[model samples]
Target: MNSADGAAVVVGVDGSEPATRAVLLAAREAVRRNRPLRVVHGFIWPLLGVPVAAPAGAPPHAGLRHQAEQLVADAVNAAQAQESGLRITGEIIDGEAAAVLIGESPTAALIVLGDRGLGGFASLVIGSVALQVTAYAECPVLVARGTARDTGPVVAGVDGSALSRAAVEFAAEAASCRGAPLRVVYARPGGRAAQAGEEERLLAESVAGIAERWPDVPITREAVHARPVAALTEASRDAQLVVVGRQGRGELSGLLLGSVSQGILHRSACPVAVVRTPG
Candidate 1:
């Protein structure tokens, strides 16, 4: 597929089982969006002691490059098997995995990565690459996690912040595409009835006009006097996907990620999609 035909859905693969899962999920998203799937494998052969250059006319780090190429090819094949007739392409680029994926964000509709990579420890809930990409990517980043067994509403954390508004927009479209209902939630600390009223208004304002844009998506709003992390994490227990802004009001605006986003990332029961507010 040509890059000119809208932004492609990009997935990073590293020859890990989790990466294969990401490929399948990304392939389905590409098919749903009617966009191409670009499967990329970031390779750093020199870091592994592979020579960057060989004698004239000879391939440089041919063995390492070939392995990277094979990884991309396998991911492509798996994507194809997941969704026949999917427009797909594969590339092996030399760079840090997070850097390569983040660089692709400018031309990508969504960046999908495995919750854990080849080097990630089993104790780690999210790999470093996934966390870095999700925190910095210009476009939305979806961390493929947990089994795709639940068929529940698309849950979104809404606080009326600019970033949360972006997350609501993204969640609305995602729900519309999947024909799933949307659950917009706003969590406030308990203690004051006056604050509860204010949060209710915020929740309402955050989701205003969503039904107009996504008329087919049924939306349900919740304003609870609970901790943001605890509320959203519990909502994720049965959600098909949990959507959150890259940053929120809890931290300074200059921060790349807020406490809520980080909390959900570490504890969400379903896949998490982090949407950044557009510049």
Candidate 2:
């Protein structure tokens, strides 16, 4: 999904290492977009039928509420440290983590989440919270993973679909903002020499307006004879950000995320941004 104009960059934190990384990345994104940063902690204790207040005679900060507040406080502090003079705020919302983030997504320019968090299964490549938010959020969802690098090209996987073109638009803006080169990759699994011309033409059409829109950003188009997931994952090896459409051509209408998009999320070597045309 696309971001609303002038909206803040929202990030979810849970006191995990991955969440901490997400905070810093969100801060960077906010600065790049010239928008404010909002750090949100989804507090689930109140919704679990547990007492939110501390027991009588107990320490003032003994309640789960206090801990939740502290988590947001610490995350806000960390984000501010990462980006001094940046407009940053924090909140403790009573709801499920994924639900809270999705609620914030409607008014946010971007939603940033950790690939995995404390609530996630250790063996899974991506957390349930992250996946849920990515699937349902109203704005684009960025999952921070692997090494955080700010010095690589911005990669976009396009297939000439409207959603793929939308992803290309997002990638162009990201590349322009970072002053990095933009690589638009189109992967065609069929290795037919006779169809090479058609594939090349479609690739060009996918990124048709990107150059005119972001004249300063260098654009490269590549047509690969490989699976989309494999090609994009390999490109992510040296990319600062990888953008893909949540649902693309040939995907089932009921699926929130296309197979190639999900594969990229699970295997990309850099941060992954899932985009779709906002309603």
List TM-score per model, in order: 0.90, 0.94
Error of 2 at 134 (Å): 0.8
The digit string of per-residue lDDT tens for model 2 on 184-270 reads 999888655635388779888998877888999999999888999999999999999999987532345877888888999999999
Error of 1 at 19 (Å): 1.1
Candidate 1 Cα errors over 4 Å, as ranges: 1-5, 47-49, 52-62, 247-254
lDDT of 1 by residue, 1-279 (tens): 233568899999999988999999899888877789999988877667776455567665456566677789889999998899998999988888998898999879999999998994888888999988988898899988775533799999987888899999999998887889999999887875654368678988899889998999999999877999999989988898999997522255666878898889888888889999877
Which pairs clash inside model 2?
1-276
- In lDDT terms, how accurate is model 1? 0.86
Residue 174 error, candidate 2, Å: 0.5
Q: Residue pairs in steric clash, candidate 1?
A: none
Estimate every model's Cα lDDT from 0 to 1: 0.86, 0.88
User: What TM-score does structure 2 among the candidates reach?
Assistant: 0.94
Model 2 poorest ten-residue lDDT run: 246-255
